[model samples]
Target: MVSSGGAAGTSATAAGAAAAAAHSYKQLKEEFVSNLSGGSVTEIAQVCAVAPVVSLLWSVLQARQSFFEPYTPLAFIVDFLLNVGALLLSVTLYSNAPLLLNLLLLTVATFIYLIPADPSIRRKKAKLPPNASSKPSPAGSSPPLGVLSTKPFLTNYRGNMLVVTCICILAVDFRLFPRRFAKVETWGTSLMDMGVGSFVYSAGIVASRPLLKEKAEGKTSPLSTRLVRSFRHSIPLLVLGVVRLLSVKGLDYAEHVTEYGVHWNFFFTLGFLPPFVALFQSALKLVPSYAALAVLLSVGYQVLLEYTELKAFILVGARDNLVSMNREGIFSFLGYLAIFLAGQDAGMFVLPRALPSRFGLSKRYTMLANMAAWTLGWWGLYFLVTNYRVGFGLSVSRRLANLPYVLWVVAFNSGLLFAFALADVVLFPGFYGATDARVEKDMYETATSKVLKAYNRNGLAVFLLANLLTGLVNMTVPTLHVGAVTTVGILGLYMVTLTGVAVGLDVYNVTIKL
Candidate 1:
């Protein structure tokens, strides 16, 4: 009996020790997460580990044909793995490397795989006589392989990218992942900022298209009428901003100066930049020239802000009384205007022209080359200004919308658009031909396409819905106390729910246009 009691006591002691160890492990995990840096090794490992699963899911759903149709299943699997591995290595270790090397490498690899030695090219070459002239054919003489579309400002690609950005922002806001995973301040420049800038710049370009096109064609309206129209157009944004601000403040949600709110950069850009740009275009008579002038003016404005220490005044609240006025909103409007003007310039170049029915390899190559040149030029300028203009205070300040910021926005947007155009050419080779209807029907009829179309159709509504849901979720849930895995699960559910609602509304032809 004494021996049996001793054995039982030993068993109980072992059980207590095991329970204590489990508790210690849980506490350690919590502490580790709380103290994680902006770019934690663990966070990087997690991203890398999950990337393949994410890629696999994306391939099955949205990237079905685009990814798998061009290559065999085995090849697709191998390439996906390699691409994800490269991306993980680049993002985690060499974050400062130029222009996301992983994406560049993947794009190049895909391009090469799709454009392998074509029998058609060999046959055409064989038919050519030995003494035939090697001069390139005229641009319009032959049917081309594919043509770049003129209306690229707010296309499905940009919309999808915006949706992804919105999701990331929501995830960060909910603390579903480590703060380092989506921390904006981690890098000198971040993909998150660039994504936001791209959306805003596209919005500016789209909003200004009609007015700029009309003015370019010498069909100018009266100044008073133009101003009134601009104001009328801005009414919706103004109302939305006010409503969002009130909701956020009333609900006592966390506030950030950069995201959408009463003082959001987007709100001020839509409300004030349009009339200003229209008036400037009226005076200049050339949209591109006005864009250049806007750049110069933006530089001057940045210098003025620096000289007067306006950023300090607003950020540090040198004067407490002026704090209520939200000088950040008032001053940052200039930078946003600069970005809008740059978009206007891009639109002037790409839009307002007859798009070719067919774009040949040579033509497409030339276009890509031109885009690359422009991207390089802007990026070089950004590098120079940011590196050398320290005394002048020029860096990628999203708040200030400085010269470097504008250049970065323009450079990255141009590069992404070019990449997307190239991808479209490869994915839908029949897109540029007279059989466009068939291609569109086949591609657009897919479930993935429908959902993307829904988001594209009601992007603003989706954004507003996300904001509202975010507030509700924060109110109801212990978001901060949740584990990372639980947080991710919640985020996924939220995004899927949002996507479903958007798709349903789209199917019913209900768009909340503003």
Candidate 2:
């Protein structure tokens, strides 16, 4: 018979061992993500290029489906595997995927799929609407022109951004996810580095829809009204921030404190940026001048970082106070607002009505041309700002959310947009938005577009779900010890599960706003 004293001692020892193991596991993760330089701009760009390649592939297959006798399940499986599945692999197992080679191969595959003269595959080519070739319809006419209409390429852009961001957040835990693509300790670029910024940019594309409409109508909401609306809209994110903070702390989750700070998390950053942007716009009355606001904020923030001791304070300051403890989140608020505004600027120009009929180019070509120009211009500025002699002479730092970093986000995203638009021209020959209309009404909706539209419609909901599942996954699985094959399997299952939920929501016409 054991004595009560011995039993108490045994319990105490086991508790200590468990505590030590938990600490070690957390320490291991902190080290895994810490003090690392990021990958090359070229590599980052290459990795991002996969988004457009897969989006184009999906669009093509769906377009072809429009021509052929529909096999709904086969279409879904083939396109999902080829497009989303390939994108998943590109980031994980093939992180070092050769850019030029993949592009060439995919390009060849695109041509082969397109150029082949299969009698069965060919059908009556989809044409513009009967009235499409006529002068633009009057505003009040039947089937009126959708002045605020969005493009599929843009929808594809936002959906792809969400999917890519979600994939990286969880996949980075596994051995299969390349360390070079992980978020850097202080400075540089990576696939993971692009996640938050791209997601913010994606969200911003639609968030400014109301503001854009108001601007077009020459209507303005009072500052107080704007504040209330912005805050009300942001409640979900704010609540999510609180929930995440509580969960991470209460559950003793493995958190790299330096990523956000002692108390701050990304949800907080996302929650607060909009209201501040609203405040700025209300004070300055710069409605629809998003590019100007973005430039002003980024450049002003960079000045503080470069000229003042603010940079050191954020980078190496003591975390003794609330402000210091969450400086990264607090300080980066403006930079992210800048990125969001840049996206808003992109959003305004993306509408078909934003392009002039006198440009001598169709809507697709006009948007593509503008996107290419914007992308090239932003890249030019990125290089310029990065070179000390030519410009600001600062490297990209997501932690700091500096000027070059903002420029990089815009450049990469816009470049991706250009790629998507180009794909529309190649695979979808008619006006960018018209092809999608024809596809749905004339025949069946391809499962690929359905999936993308589902994601686009409920991005925040999907993001929340991804976060929850990521935490659940971490607790359930030994992510660190998992082999490449196991990691891939887990990721495939995880992604399919997410897509399924998203599709399920769409099927029921149930949208998760909060």
Question: In terms of TM-score, how similar is model 1 to the real structure?
Answer: 0.67
Winner by lDDT: 2
Off by over 4 Å in 1: 1-154, 176-188, 211-218, 257-269, 286-290, 322-324, 352-366, 388-393, 435-448
lDDT of 2: 0.77
User: Positional deviation of 292 in candidate 2, in angstroms?
Assistant: 1.6
lDDT of 2 at 428: 52
Give the per-residue lDDT digits (tens) of candidate 2, residues 365-432. 77777888888988898889998887768889999889988988888888887887777566655443
How much lDDT does each candidate structure score? Answer: 0.54, 0.77
List the pairs of residues colliding in candidate 1.
146-359
TM-score: which candidate is best?
2
lDDT of 1 by residue, 157-194 (tens): 54555455556555554443435554343123444556
Residue pairs in clash, model 2: none
TM-score of each candidate structure, all chains considered together? 0.67, 0.91
